[model samples]
Target: MKKIIAYNMLMVALFTPICCAQDIARIVEDVGKSVVVVIGFNVDSTANKLGSGCFINNKGVILTNAHVIDSCLSLQIELTDTIIEVAANSNGLFCTTRKTIKIYLTKCS
Candidate 1:
């Protein structure tokens, strides 16, 4: 019985990482679908900042760092082949009712 238990424990230890690796791979694939490129434009309409963010939900809500869109007059969100341009408000909020897009900013540093 002692030898059987030891063998089972060793088998579990070796297989556990394999199972976890599959889970990690699935998570990475899922997250890749939600990733987007955030481009910030200066007052002169030139792209000055670049960052990456992810869609938090299916309603076009994006979650990104505050610094990515800071001091910008407009922003361009690129997802796959779609590029969306929206104006930013003074309080760092980007909203466009026409496209039902909203951006939520958080300080990453």
Candidate 2:
């Protein structure tokens, strides 16, 4: 019936956010091992603090903010689990790597 369809649509809409959030959480978790937290500044003297990055390729490619790296020529990736650091660099935007990693955190944001 039309009423039933409408009710179902409403229910789905209400739960869509939860589903999307879960999906994002999964992505975050899956990439947490390859992701890193970055902090730096921008050219305009603004405090561009606190950001995150993830790897998407097997060649140690990393993605993050140009501003967060303070526009530096190179970068450093810190893994959450192994607590290891890797030297890297970015070309103004996003990095790439295919490595899967586990992120350890008391809270996720």
TM-score of every model versus the real structure: 0.65, 0.42
Candidate 1 residue lDDT tens string, 23-54: 99999988887999999999899999999989
Question: What overall lDDT, based on C-alpha atoms, would model 1 receive against the true structure?
Answer: 0.81
Query: What is the C-alpha local distance difference test score of each model?
Result: 0.81, 0.53
What shift in Å separates residue 1 of candidate 1 from its native position after superposition? 2.4
- Model 2 Cα shift for residue 19 (angstroms): 1.8
Give the per-residue lDDT of model 2 (tens digit) for 11-107.
9999999999999999988866676665444445444455777765655555665445654333334557543322233334324342554222111
**Alpha-carbon error at 42 in model 2, in Å?**
21
- Model 2 TM: 0.42
The root-mean-square deviation over C-alpha atoms between each candidate and the true structure, in angstroms, is 4.1, 10.1
Single out the weakest 10-residue window by summed lDDT for candidate 1: 98-107
